[model samples]
Target: MAKAVSDSAQMIARMAPVLDSQDYCFCHVADDHKFHAASVLATFREEEGLTLVLPLAQAQAAGLAGPAFRRITLQVHSALEGVGLTAAVAGALAEGGIACNVVAAFYHDHIFVPSAQARDALSILQRLSAAARR
Candidate 1:
């Protein structure tokens, strides 16, 4: 059985904002469609074709190129319907003309946005949350 999300907006409310102010260097890692490769965090020789986040500090320390992506952490108590959440958020961002990448963990959902647009995305999410509350 799956626990249903009663309020989509409320779920977004509980999410913590991850501010991104620097560029993060991210690679495709051999086009395998997997980001879990051991070398994903390593092997940074140049910055071509890499997705840069923001700040670039944290990513650099980890041997990752930067600015770092702005991330939002949503703690979904129930099993997340990736399609639903992604569609909702992606729609919101798309409306704002912002690009997003989503990653799911065991207990939470994470949204990654371009560093420059993080604040705007947060505002949009906040609005979505408030709307859900209604």
Candidate 2:
């Protein structure tokens, strides 16, 4: 298994955020649809309904719509218990006036930025990483 990084500085220095080419959106799962877990990127159950992060195309095909977002995957395998990485990334993006939604899985942290601001978000992250290496 790949080693996980717990050092905040190392995690920031090696984040290697890569933007996904496809667009995605968050939408409520259809009331009557039974979605296969593997088909969607992520899901969260809430009091209202299931919220799904789905490819923009898939969501549009299913007649669901929301603001488009681009996923930036931090390639660093940050340990689950690690601190500051998310805060640093979010703080950087926030300083650039970009809102960020983060999803922390076992392996990597994913940052979702507005589709229109994806490149800007990626640049901010790259600079953050470069600064950490300096």
Query: Which residues of candidate 1, in runs, are more than 4 Å off?
Result: 1-24, 29-55, 61-67, 81-83
lDDT of 1 by residue, 71-106 (tens): 766655435653456667789889999898776665
Report the C-alpha lDDT of model 2 over 1-134, residue by residue, as the tens digit: 67999999999999999999999999997556686667699988887888999998888887887999999999999999999999999999999999999999989999999999999999999999999999
Tell me model 1's lDDT, rounded to 2 decimals. 0.59
lDDT of 2 at 38: 76
Which pairs clash (backbone N, Cα, C closer than 3 Å) in model 2?
none
In model 1, the Cα lDDT at residue 124 comes to 88
By TM-score, the best candidate is: 2
Q: What is the C-alpha lDDT of each candidate?
A: 0.59, 0.94
- Clash number for each model: 21, 0
Candidate 1, position 5, lDDT: 52
Give the range of the ten consecutive residues with the poorest summed lDDT in model 1.
36-45
